[model samples]
Every structure is written in structure tokens, then in C-alpha cells.
Target: MPFIIGTPIPDNKILVQSVSHIYGIGLSKSKMLCQRAGFGDDSRGLNVTPHKSKFLENLMDKSNLLLGADLRRFQNDKIRKLYTIMTYRGLRHKKGLPVRGQRTHTNAKKRAHFNTNVS
Candidate 1:
């Protein structure tokens, strides 16, 4: 393949290390996105090709996955929407809790207290 200058290659490492390059993407979520994108969990960033880069960008756009350049836009939108819906429901959404019909009894982070002052 001809060397494409300036384009990045997406593989396991990049997915794991710096997938935040995409909009709405973060470390934990990026791993899941990469998994769903079929790049495996341990892929490297340098291995990504121009085609993969295009695929990733398209995938992120289509699925609301975060990537390069416009991440803050999504963050701001999410924050704004969260505030607009502010209520127990809005707080739930902001905290990433189960909103629709998921059980939280098994894992309630908010219910549990983390006291740094105890130290």
C-alpha cells in the first residue's frame, strides 16, 4: 500500500491508549466501541490504516461514538441535555445509572459512600 501521510492507523494499541481522538469517546467506552467495531480489545493505534480511520470516523458518527475535533460539542450537548432534564431522572442519566428498566440494587455507586476524609 502507498504510504499515506498524515492519516492515522487504528489498531489495538491506539484503541486502548488514545481512542479519545474520536468524538464522544472515552477510555472505558472506547474499549467497548473498538470491540463492537471488531478491532479486538488489544489492537494498536499505529496499525490503523486510512481505510480503518475512515471506517472509525464513520462508525463514530453513525453510532454517536466520540472522536477527533468535535468531542467538546458532544460533551456540551450531553451536559445541556442533562440539565434540561434535571430531576431525579436527569441526575440518574448524568450518573450513568440504569434509566429505563435495569436493576441497580446489585451495583449502586451513589448509594455507597467514598469518604476520603476518613483517612
Candidate 2:
């Protein structure tokens, strides 16, 4: 396939999967990211330019993708922000109800350690 935007994509079919190789980017979201970055829906894994590669690497690193950011970065950030709001102990203070949302009275067994029976 012709190189997209003058960038040579990697020949590895697996690497071009968008979501599998990238952190903070899921299959769907990866498509969006590629779209945003002007990378069309081509199955080719463009070898990011040196500058682009550095930019992406740095971006991923700063975004807390130490292990990976493909899709978890978004979730990680959300959970982290919630925990910060409750001072890391808000979960316990609020009876294990997720500070973000979720019905506590019926579907919160994992967090209810004070006096709840899982069975």
C-alpha cells in the first residue's frame, strides 16, 4: 500500500492493529486517534517518522502509559481523579460506593468490607 502522508508504515501486520500496539488506544478509540492524526483506516502500520515517534513516545510516557496506554490511560485517569477527590479514603468513608457512580445498595460487594457478605 502507498505510504500514508509520506510516512512509511511498519510492515508488521500485527503492529498496525492500532489498538493492540498502542496504550490508551482501544480498537475503536485507536481508529479515532488515527483519524485525528490524519492516519486513514488503512491496515498498514506506518513507521512513525523520527520526530513523530519521539513525540508519540513522550506523549505516551507523560500520559502515565509506563506499562501501556492503548485504552487504560483514559480509565486510569478517571479512576485516579475520583480517588483524589475522596482523598484516597473516600471509598471507605462513603461505604464503598464508587465516588463516580454505580448503585451502592445493590451492586457494591467488593467495596463493602465493613459488614457485607458476598454470598
Q: State the displacement of the C-alpha of residue 98, model 2, in Å, after optimal TM-score superposition.
A: 21
lDDT per residue (tens digit) for residues 15-36 in model 2: 3374335443456645554454
TM-scores, all candidates, are 0.43, 0.34
What are the per-residue Cα lDDT tens digits for candidate 1 across 22-104? Answer: 44456776676567667776667766666776666566667753445466777678767875877665565555665565677
The CA lDDT of each predicted structure is 0.57, 0.50
The prediction achieving the highest lDDT against the true structure is: 1
